[model samples]
Target: MSTSIATSHTATPHKGLPPGPKGTWIGGNLSQIGPRRVDFFLMLAQTYGPIASFRAGRWRLFLVSDPELIQQVLVTDARSYIKHFGARTFKPVLGNGLVTSEGDFWLTQRRLLQPAFLKTQVLSYAPVMAELTEAMLAKWVPGTSVDIAFEFSALTSAIALKTLFGLDDHGDRVRVDESLRLTFELLTHRLDSLFQVPLVFPTPANLRLKRAIADVNAVIDGFIAQKQAAPPGNDLLSTMIAAQREDGTQMTAQQLRDEAMTLYLAGHETTALTLTWSWYLLSQHPDVEQKLVAEWQRVLGGRAARASDLSALTYTAAVINEAMRLYPPVYVIGREATTDLELGGYRVKKGYTILMSQWVNHRDPKYFPEPERFLPERWLDGLASRLPKFAYYPFGGGQRLCIGVHFALMEAAIVLATVGQQFKFTLAPDAVIDIMPQITMPPKYGMPATLTRR
Candidate 1:
């Protein structure tokens, strides 16, 4: 049975703005979207049609859920759009990195960095990924309770440190991890708050954010200086350090820092959340866990998963796909229009921000029957090929698609299989798991579970 959702980009006859929930005179829909943005965006799509309009402060925003509209915004008319103000909020930390830069500069940097993340290049890191994961498992003992979220975060962070910087020193990894946590938490706070405080104001929060950023920059700078002094290795930092532009000019120190920070943060955080959520879902669905382990046993047979083995681990990949379907790490992505446009028969003026949410689109019943159920088997067939392009985008779409898509998938699969073969988690009775939609969605209270040796 084909589960693909039929969608069309043929615009309806020009109408006024799409319907949406009304908001107060001063704040618009900012208050309504407080904290629970993922749920709020889903509600907007459910209550209104695909293209829903609202206001946040001075910004006119549209929550576009229809697959065709999403395609138009992300791919067809992508040139007419750029990342929204929300993404720019992290520029303090990300600098002019790929995630924060735009236009020609972003294109150049992307081109310079693209070859480093090629599938063939990424596959070489498989051994490092599995080794780091095995090292993590070596520390775990059955019947020991752990904060599963933190455990995975640490493991992925370590893997990222090794792959990105060629740093195996435990001390450097801890420093980077702590500073990143503080910086992101502060940045997320700034993003969620309606009122803005200038970073130069020396306010308590601004001061804290500044210090956190400084700490992260200092660590990155140290790594760069070390990389510059040493012989070039195969790590991402070394690649970026040696990357040159078309004019034969190498990336300046600042550019290297920006790109390194962007890759470092982007590389680990999302994959960690993927593993975290995968474990949570598998814990809740034992039958699915059993099947996943069975596949691993038949294929891996007491060995760590390799990049070549990824193709044969059908059930393992399905579990990851299903996990992402239910709880996408980057649940929502927004773009601001560069010119006036029409979408879903509504006029979208210049400067309007459009949000395309995976949380909403991934749950659309047209594409996913019984959308809330954790069903990995749904992806075992040719469902991905059958689905419309933007209907199930987890990493996103368009020219600006995540460069680390293959790397993240490979790391997630290797880590999932290696860890799953050794142990399974049982959620603690008192554990409270809820989504906290920050830059990436993580459990609000953290996932507490007991490790049960498989």
Candidate 2:
């Protein structure tokens, strides 16, 4: 692997970091980040151009809004960067899972887990995704209001656990669901807070978060104990259990727990948010919704969608893509510079935080015309192929690109096709939709919609 090491000496010692909005001496631009960092990032890109520098407390951050620079950081020169310190918040929960690890260890874990996310494996999980969505739709009564976010959260959680660990028993699944929800809520709460105390503190929020983590860990431990005794199964957890290294050794119990938790978080949260935003966008744009429904009807002939239907559901896929472009689930990607580097003509010093915002890039007018509008048709013309690689990365890019890209895409398409086939969601009268920026972006007030039977 090609890696860039941070150089204490600069080729041009006089050159400095890129320009950004000035801030307080100590706080820097952190105070400006406020509750809506996504918006602030967008504004920074608009105000200071693609590569901008700002300080948040003692931390140095460089926002790479330009697609080429983004590509440099994520794809062409990925080895020069590693997981940033901010990811430490997840370390308490994720352990040394794929998202948190770096170097040889991360590469080993990636290789071992790769087989589980291959094309054939992801395609096999589609029926479960569709079935779970169908089950969810079955519970929705016409004209009744529901929080689509919460509903999709439950649906995707079930799909994630089943696909990852072969969870089938309804009782155990419910317990996992409850625990996962509490854990995510606590995590999100912690992420949004500006002044976070250490987890060791007996603060109420920390206490609750600790309890939620323990509950989640217990659920995963149960899954591990059961899978340990059984024959190797088709699920991701089982695949990890059966995975062998160059030395023909398997992952340890702690490693298994780490991966399971990582999958549990990375697999479900973004997908649930993707579906939630898709439904919300569809509700707001009737023409898009009509086109989506028409595609489902034309493709499925009033039956449920299948993995086989994914290819035929082009418009359905486009709608989901467009929804993600508007409100990407993981809005920002962060990496730390391992060595000194020049990115987009700016001299990036070693140890600087590199921030790339999909929220900003996906909405840039240069790459996406009518950037603010929900226009799925734009995607139908192969725009993704023509535009820059990093322009529309809802699933990210390069080696560290989301391991579950195929799985998430197929799941989104199947869920939309199945759920859209039988029901259409209209935003509830009192619904106040806004972005809640966390590890995964979601609607702050929840997506309140009244489900109508088709």
Candidate 3:
């Protein structure tokens, strides 16, 4: 659980920097950190040891792979940091939502939205999660080839729509889906680009991004309007709509849209990736899949999964935990230092950005033996409890830990149990599994698989 790097590779007192790969005078590590950034971070950690420093353009970024160092950035010194610039790129799409907001406003929003994601509240949505999974499974035909990633994405999106806004209309779901896809794709492009043009500029990409944001905003606005016209409901949006601050002020209209969009994106995308990667891993390891199926058969006996059945599905949870360890949905989380500080014996300037990569930490050979292999059995022996908290953080950590952690885990388990009871997937002959590290790490090439009844 305690991963120690070579003391020799640790930060040295040379220009107050940690040991890292040297780069060009102008671009620094930016040019070298091409498309597959997850791999780049992994290389940084492996090559330079746990705490590595590099520059991306003008950004003084440190890749902190040490679990103790990660803990300091995410928990102990969390208040000294804010979300890095990469997160801010999606503000046009996310608005001032929880994911991007900072300081007192972020705290207030977190407190207001906390009730809806509480364990008891999240459990109330388990039936809906199972129902939606069943609906998806109802359409699956044995011997048919499908993109498993797309299937799970659509399924989780539907669950998000229904659970967040109480709207199950297919048209609205498709509209929001398309708009968000376009919006995220555009924002990702901007995030990768070296020179970002202001949104005010009428560049073609900016114009397209603007339209995409407006399209999604239109869908969200309509949902809000409908929710306002009707009686209050149990959905998250309704909760947000009714929530008032200690000063008796309610969230403004824009605030509602931002928070709703944040919840919708966070609620679905990561869970979708979790399930997607889980199926992919299950496809590769039949022995593991068989063990998972046996557990599901013993627990549910061909019935749909319920919230109460979660604790009984030990192997199922292990499979998810292991899959996330290998391909974490939110691969890397970055925090910008708000003031000059010392980390791992190196002076972190006010604007320095610290990146803790789950992609790197989760695979630490010290924590997980045979880290590259998909071994769900490793977690069956209470490994999670033994590992350093930040070493296996798929849901993140600290005060800003994902509010929907319980909800996502429950949904993943239920959906996995509900679907695994009936069908198992086999990867297509020519399927090329690769990581596409955007806001989340989804398969670069879609997961092509044929379904078969278990």
Looking at model 3, which ten-residue stretch has the lowest summed lDDT?
A: 1-10
The model with the greater lDDT, 1 or 2, is: 1
Tens-digit lDDT track for model 3 on 85-158? 99988888888999999999999999888888899989999999999899888999999999998899899989
Off by over 4 Å in 3: 1-15
Give me the runs in candidate 2 sitting further than 4 Å from their true place: 1-14, 169-196
Per residue, candidate 1 scores C-alpha lDDT tens digits across 1-454 of 1222234446553556778899988788888998878888888888887778898877889888888878888988899998898998889999999998999999998888888789998998999999989999998999999998889888888888888788774676678778877777788888777788999899999999899888889988987888889899988788888877889999988989999889888889999999999999998999999899889989999899999999999999999999999999999899999888877667778898999999999999989999999999999888999998988999998998899999999999999999998998999999988988777898999999999888
lDDT of the structure predicted as candidate 2: 0.83
Candidate 1 Cα misplacement greater than 4 A, ranges:
1-15
Q: Which residue pairs in model 3 clash with each other?
A: none
Candidate 1 vs 2: which has more TM-score: 1
Score residue 351 of candidate 2 by CA lDDT. 90
lDDT of 3 at 381: 90
Ranking the candidates on lDDT from highest down gives: 3, 1, 2
Model 2 TM-score, all chains together: 0.93
- Cα error, residue 92 of model 3, in Å, equals 1.0
